[model samples]
Target: MLKKQRILTASALIAVSLMFGSCKSDYEKLKASNDVAKKYREAVKYYNKKDYNKALDLFDDLTQRYRGKAEAEDLFYYYAYTNYKLKDYTSAGYHFKNFAENYPSSTRAEECRYMAAYCSYLDSPNYQLDQTNSSKAIEQLQLFINLYPKSERVADASKLIQNLRNKLEEKSYADARLYYDIGDYLSAVMAFNNSLRDYPDTKYAEEMEFMMIKAQYLYARNSLYYKQEDRYNQAISYADQFTEKYPNSKYLREAASYRKISDQGIKQAKVLVAEASVDSKVAKKLAKKDTTTGQPQSVVGKQNERSPQNQ
Candidate 1:
């Protein structure tokens, strides 16, 4: 009985040795199979050295190989950052967006979202150029704020939105002012009108109102005699708006003066027409005289006498 028990014990020991040896062999195989952890370390080393291209290649390969593996999140984040540091903004934006969408509940998701928006913001053109990226950055950042209302990054997003909006505003105002400078009164009016619609509460609103008045006034001044009536009315419309909106503005006095001149010119035009219709000879005499010569001669004689109410 003792001998049989020894044989059974030895057999059990051999079975355990084979199982342990197989486990050790498998561990060795995994260790030799291009150690992912070692690759991750090397990639980080390359990134620290600012060899972005090499770092990016390693990070990209690791991210794909370890899609759902232990270090996948860290690897993917560094992958996106590598692209960003390399100034490959489009690819950086794409990877960052992907990171945000795929890892919405991850610890770094909010940061990923913000970085995605910032990537586009970084690619925005100069203030004078097409602002497609600038517009997109605004929309995406607003969306990010909506998504993470209580994020610590909210302040940054708000500031970035303001900066981008200011760019658009600057472009609009510059174009509007250019129109004013070039004497395209109609186009100037349109541009200023659109600018106000876009930025009604801006500090430039006051300046814009002044510009609008000037444009309309000039438009009226340059109109043909036949077109003067309509143009004058348009000038009065803008002048009235300025006076109503900025009652205490320094430009108010000038605006009022313009208003008065337009009113007086229209009245004088009517009086001249009425006089010419009644007596062509006196009208011709008055037409040859200058009204500013400090002369008290009766230019409107019987015409004024005929319309006492108008006197």
Candidate 2:
């Protein structure tokens, strides 16, 4: 029985290999044939069967031969789709865009145009990669909307734009958070503030605002006494903004505590500034007396030291 089972499996494998080999043999023969019509026929068959690689090879061969002919419309349309189905999105995008531009009045033109831009959307990488493709996708999608305001795809395009925008926002948030995690408090404060400015309507707005104030508080706490007063004041201002916008925020209590600490920082900084100013004024006054008396301060100090009725 085991010997019989092995024979059956071997037979199945041989049949499968023969089928694939015959398909390859037919494709190679058609490729070498000078008949564009036969090639087109076989390309359609391959496309219908979802054999996109074979379809792509044949379509690529036929594009030049069929150009400017009546058959070019359907041929070019399928050619672009062949590339798309092959997952060569960059080439697909270009070819699809070209088809729409070349066949402006075709019923398929609008669909191809939308697909071209959608391909770019599909090509956009995740947030961890460079954002060049994401930005490009946004541009392409927006242009599609402007060109085809009545297109049924416009709503889906808008949703895709927002989704891509959210990804960019996440990258920005992560960059700011990284600074905070690395103990770069001042940079974190600036980055979080910039993020909020760039994406005011972001879903991360509340969290960003909360982090910004927290970053500012840390920045103020670490700053030199002379710089702390202004930084602490900024932290307080951010906290106020957060409270006003999201009074019911889950982070409200923590944010309030950060604000309180910032207030105390400002008070301490103010005291230091006052003491510094008083010391500066006293030093200047003594210097002015020495200058008016036409004596060096060191000489005056020595004279005072000697004259002390000690003799």
Candidate 3:
């Protein structure tokens, strides 16, 4: 019984090896064949059988050989989709876009253009990564909509554009918010303001406005004495605008606190600026007139009237 079982297993292995060898031999013959038509037929067979890697290999070679022929357009379209099915979206998008542009009169032009944009959308990475592909997808999708207003894919393209737009908005918002987290208050203030300006309808509007107010207040509080008055006033302005825009926002209370802080900061900054200005003028006058060895009598009298420290 053990000898018979060993024989059966050995025979099965031999049969499997022969089957693979036969398939490999056939593939070799197809590769070396001068018959483009035969290769095209085999590629389509493999594609229909869901063997996209094999189909892609065959189609990639055929596309270069079959250029300018009647079957070229169909072959090119299939070639792009074969790459798409194999998860090579970058190549797929490029070829599909090329097909649409080169064969504008083809019945599949609109579909190819849509597929090109869809491939770009598929290739778009997460928002935290560089969004170059997502931006390109938006451009491609918009172009498709412009070119094919009557095509059924236009609605879907618009929706896809909106989705990519939201991703971009999120990326921009996160980047701006990061400045605040890192204690770069001035840059955070500008970044948040620019983000809001760019995406007025972003879902983060309330949170962004509140954070912007906080950033502005912190920026003012840390600024030089001369600059703090203007900066704190700017924070107060931002808080006022935020409250007017979102009175019932969840951040309203926090926004009001920033407003109060900004108001107090503004008064304190103004007083500091005033004192610094007076001290600067006094120091300048003392420096210019105190050319005497020890101290000029007039300057010393002025210092006594004010304070000897000012001298």
Candidate 4:
């Protein structure tokens, strides 16, 4: 009885395997066939089933063949989205932009345009990496908004643009902080100023301003004695501006302290300058006196004075 039951189970398993193999063979035959209509239909069926890889393969094959045909529009749309579903964002972005350009009058054009920009946004790297994609995403999103001012997607595009811009701002802030960390105070001050100029409303504004004051102070402190007074004055000016702009800031106390130190530095720098000037004048006087009296007499004068006619 056990042997008989085992034989029955083996027969059932073989039947199921053959059925599955036949289904797979049918798909393989369809893939190799020259039936364009059947291929297109199967591609759509696969797409609906969320088999994006198979759908993309068929769509790619049908793309040029369907060109100028009425089916091309839907075919291209599906093709673009299939790439997107497969997470090929760069290709998706290109195809989506092409779709928007090719079917400007289509109702899907606006959505495709926004999707193109959003894909670029999705492609943007982390804040520490290069921001070319982030910048490109912002531009694309902005263009979408400009092209479709009343689009419901405009709000979403605007938000995406802002997010990209924030990432760029973060990159700029980190670069400036790098200059500071490396003790390149002058470069740090310039970089921090550029960060502020580029992003006037950056969340890092307060911290950047405070850092500018500190950077400037350190730069002034490290300058040559002759240049210190003016540089320190500049630092004091930065500190004053920071304090005036953010009086209630947590960095206010530190900024004020920097200002005080800069003021003292300016005073000391002036004293050093004055002492240097006095020392320079004294050295010049002593040099003139040495030239006039301390130098050896000329050979002719010594010879004349020691002549035997005088003896």
Which candidate number has the best TM-score?
A: 3
Q: What's the lDDT for candidate 1? A: 0.77
lDDT of 2 by residue, 161-240 (tens): 99999989988998988888877877787898899899988888899888888777666665566677788788789989
TM-score of each: 0.69, 0.76, 0.84, 0.81
Model 3, span 1-311: residue lDDT tens: 99999999999999999999999999989988889999999999999999998888899889889999999998998999898888899999999999999999999999999999999999988988899999999999999988889998888999999999999999999898788877777777788889889998988878888887777766665556556668878878998998998888987777777777667666765665567577987445433432112211221123331221222
RMSD of each: 18.2, 12.7, 10.3, 15.1
Worst 10 residues of 4 by lDDT: 290-299
Clashing pairs in 2: none
Error of 1 at 37 (Å): 6.6
Worst 10 residues of 1 by lDDT: 291-300
TM-score (C-alpha, index-matched) for candidate 4:
0.81
Tell me how far candidate 1 lies from the true structure as C-alpha RMSD in angstroms.
18.2
Question: Relative to the true structure, how large is the alpha-carbon lDDT of every model?
Answer: 0.77, 0.81, 0.81, 0.83
C-alpha RMSD in Å of predicted model 3 compared with the true structure: 10.3
Candidate 4 residue pairs that clash: none
For candidate 3, the lDDT comes to 0.81
- Backbone clashes (count) for model 3: 0
